[model samples]
Target chain A: MKLLFSNEVKEHRFSLKCIPHDTDMQKIENIDVSVFPDNITGKDIDSHGNITIFGYTKELHDSFGFDVEGTASTGLKDFESAKELHMVGMYKYQTKITAPGESVLDFSKKHSLESCSSNEEKALLIMQNLNNEFEYRQGCTDMDTKAEEALKGGCGVCQDFAHIMLSLCRLESIPCRYVTGMMIGEGRSHAWVEAWDDNRWIGFDPTNGKVVNDEYIKISNGRDFRDCLVNQGIFTGNVTQSQTISVIVNEEQNLIHD
Target chain B: MISYMDICGKRDRVEDMEIYTGADVVNEQLARYGVKFGIYKNNEFKEQLFPFDMIPRVIDNKEFAYLEKGLKQRVKALNLFIADIYGEKKIIKDKIVPEEFIYAGSGYLPQCEGIVPSKGVYSHISGIDLVQSKDGTWYILEDNLRIPSGASYPMIVRGIERRSAPSLFTGKHIEDNRNYADMLRHTMDYVNCGGHTVILTPGRYNAAYFEHSYLAEKTGAHLVSGHELIVENDHLYFIDYSGRKERVGAVYRRISDEYLDPMSFNEESVIGIPHIFDIYRKGNVALINAPGNGVADDKGIYYFVPKMIKYYLGEEPILNNAPTYLPYYDEDMKYVLDNFDNLVLKDVAEAGGYGVVFGNKMSKEEKEKFIAMLKAEPRRFIAQEVIDFIDIDIMEKGQLLPRKADLRAFVLMAEEPMVWKSGLTRFSRNPDSFIVNSSQGGGFKDTWVLSQ
Candidate 1:
């Protein structure tokens, strides 16, 4: 199956703000993206893994809107890992899960997870633990909610789930990374984890508590949600702005890779 | 003792003693020259003049040469360590430095992975602080690999101080500190991809805002704020006052790593360019003293720097670290616990002389509380031997008094590591205080390296 991922992000500011423009929403290489209302010219992939699309008109604005669409070729291949991993794979993703610091370490010890034994087993165990531990309550956690906060409350969205999973996996020395992508399902934006193992990277969805397949379209990857943030912006004003973002990933049957 | 008066001789010293005697006039001139520092203390923001002592701390030619070699070697090993940390874990895997110190460290950033700077140089400008003991052995006090300030202080002040009393410098052959700006320009250019160089400053409210602006003026690079810069087509562009955008190939950004890009870091930072990090990630621009260098300078990691020098360069370290012990190790913790009153404790996360505490000065209750904190979080603190360091003479109230001082040497890493001949030798004004940071009640002396 092929897929079409789309989003329309509208930011409404009550006051006239100095429009230091922002182009944070990325276009992944696996997907071809198109923008609506035109004139949003600059589009470039950033350092880690994300495309930065700019709408650069620095004049003060009351409201700004962007319409984006990405059509990608999708197929569910065998669950085999990549052949060769780079030297950076060894310890790069072994980041300190500082948010839920000691608890994550305790959780790993409690589970008796040894990553050297099996990345598949440890990743699945971590995902299951996260899914069981927390309830997917949307309004219960905000963007500022850390892993420990969410873990303590036993509630959060996909970002919290991914973060908690990252914490546990890293504590196990699994070399896990945070990933922001679309899974061709009914949801806003999504977050997951990719654990490096046996010289390859494999995706795991702690939010839904399952192994990721070709239905998943990767946009960006980093150590945590903070590193792979989808969109961020600021302007000159004492007034706060409201953000309205809608992301849709629909199946497209005809757009298969030739 | 080794003093400037010895090099100039009593005749030249008395003739140029006008420069030392006319301190009030030089300070007034410094105030007019906009040599100010912004410090926030007790919730109050105050901009005050960074007090300059007319009396210069002079190091003879032979001593400076040794310091230069040690500084260059130390920075080289640190750079290699950074590269190795980001690339292969050969050092960590080999157990030269424990893995916990690297991953568990607050300084380490996973976001810096896979990033090999244009020349494999992570810490392009390292500010290594050293202090001489009574026995004449200089030990490195701290390694500041991140956006190290105070270079411009010595660079600008030496010129102003020399002009204040030309007769003082007429007979003495003091190595010119003017080349710092040129060295900065060269370092920026050495890493430049294709476009022009720009100095990215947070604003005038920062502690070293004067240094930021002064360096920009001296280096002839555009001084830009987060607002003036924009990320477009995977490259950084600085918008001029006339609204014309010029491509920026290299940025000597003064902004902290956490506040450099709102899209990539602290989301609420209005002072950061939204996706400028994106430009850096794509190799469109070079960031001076590349981000994620804190891991190399982490207080805990400082213990293993000598080991890194041996591991990376296959050479014995010329410089010695101040006999320091991290509370993380069982043996070191025991040593710290036993010798509680003799050592000075430093919190790894805190900077600017805020988190330092003398063990001998702590009251019983305070000591107990500190011990509890240390036991609870061993990685957070490190203990060091308090060197009864040699005091330098500073003219205070027309009388020369001994004051504790430390030298901050600027090492710029371009093709090869170059140690600036002169350094910013800051001294504590208070008799009992060991902290010599500008934020603390301290003054600075112009460090003069003798030509002969």
Candidate 2:
């Protein structure tokens, strides 16, 4: 990630949620993180268990950046006990960015989601329906776009797709969360949904109409897109600022086996 | 209950009468001290003097004892509720408070999960508002757990009144209210992380800036803003004017939680110290009242507070919450619709006397529209039977006028809950209005707890 300020800015404070942590399905190994200007950085875990790196730059600078590199081994693991899921209840309710509107409500009612038998089934059906409905197009929606607006627009990125799926799944009383991470083919970070069924969290990629497997590496998960922001910051510059972010994932097995 | 005059005797009553006649003199001293609250109207900021009424609201010793116990119990239960909401959530699992109420309220902060504050305290300072009805029954009006103000107003007023009328203090058996600063300091010290204590204020423009500065002066803690503070090495430091770094142990932050940390909360906040919450999460520093306490004081959650007391502490609530009905429940919805004209409806998302509307005061068309809104978003509104408050006498323009008033009692949490002996008695200056918020043109009085 890189941030370019049109004018020299001082007191640049930033927080990044780009580092992936060890989860039930992913084990992060050999992690390295570096923030530009060589300032001291602090690493802490947020309420959602995501690794957060935060720091302040007191010197004047026109540009700043940070780099994170890690290896994540992804596969299914033992399910956590139901008693330990302290934050699962939060995902059952809709957030501001995921709350259903007239369009989403109509879509859910047309599908008759209430008659669905199980949480997993309801979630899969919503994923399929969202994949078929939404166009995989950028610029149609931004970070502040709500699920209802994205659905009405008929096109959005992975974040909007994940939000719409979350809204629909929650409407059916299925506890679901939004996940931000990287996939093998995608050159950038992606967003998806994880629905808690029975006693385990089952990942679903509504944008691709597929279940999350070993190819998908999870970074952070929360109630909606708001919780999984990769990078956010504030500074004293009244000058225009721009940001560029990219993510690349490769398998160690392929390099070794070859 | 003995009246003030009866307790003071004839000789002392003559001296006390001089204080009542000298209200203007007391207010002058208050003005010189910059005791005023700021309010915004149409995007314009205005600072108005919070008029001081000389006649104090005297609570009998026995009545105050009951109130002290009830306030202590209520604050303790509330603290436990906040801890559970962010920790084990046993209250939600036990079905005492529904999951929807916890997550749907905007007060629920996802960034505060699984973290316990220093000393395991949430609401280190709680201001619980209560009013006495015409039947002489005290009902809890609201809970201001997060950054509750108005205590300093009464605290400052008492000192001026004593200097203005020395006889009222020497002859009368009223508990000295000047000990609020000591109680506040102890609460902060009990949760200190082994460094200097500071009071974090947003700026001079905040509504409670007077209180923030006054309490800091009294408690002898440095008052600093966001820019004067820095986070380094996973700890908070205050940069003094001499460019020396001072570690801050406990912060009685007067800013709202969302605006306290730009990195962890609202990123657009310019008046917040970045990474402060990260250090707080690591237990390097203590935030007074703690973040995420809003979840417990939300109006929608207020209906379940008495139940929380029963669930968490296994005790019956000593005080009563005013007869309130949530439209979220079907039975309550029916009752609200049937008796819509007799109840006062409040929006759960609003505060500071903004979103309250009496049903009988609305026009027919407006009532229909409001009822439709009430039906559409049932969880957004709460209907309550309006409690007829007993009129408290305020000497306005040299004549005693009857007006509605409420007491905001402060409770500071140390090893145990300490309820202050005096409270801020705010009365609506307008005779017909029930809202006594200082922002809405209300005057205040000192609440005297009888020492006998």
* lDDT values, one for every candidate: 0.76, 0.87
Runs in model 2 deviating more than 4 A are A77-87, A254-258, B5-16
lDDT of 2 by residue, B1-452 (tens): 33444555433333346556568889999999999999989999899999988877889989999999999999999999999999889988788888888888888988899889999999999999999998789999899999999889999989888888777678678898999999999999999997899999999999889999999999999999998999888888999999999899999999999999978788888888888998999999999989999999889999999999899889999999999999999999999999998999999999998899999999999999999999999999889999998777787665667889899999999899999999999999998999999889999988899888
lDDT at position B208, candidate 2: 87
**Per-residue CA lDDT of candidate 2, range A1-258, in tens?**
888889999887777888888877778899988888767578788887788887778899999888888888776553322333444888888888888999999988777656568887788888988899789998999989999999999999999999999999888777888999999963778999988887788899999999888788888888888788887777777799888888888777732211
Quick one: RMSD of model 2?
2.6
Look at candidate 1 and give me any clashing residue pairs.
none
CAPRI docking class of candidate 1: incorrect
lDDT of 2 at B445: 88
> How far off is residue B296 in model 2, in Å?
1.1
Displacement of the residue A30 alpha carbon in candidate 1, Å: 7.9
Candidate 1 matches the true fold with a TM-score of 0.85
Task: Tell me the native contact fraction for each prediction.
Answer: 0.15, 0.76
lDDT of 1: 0.76
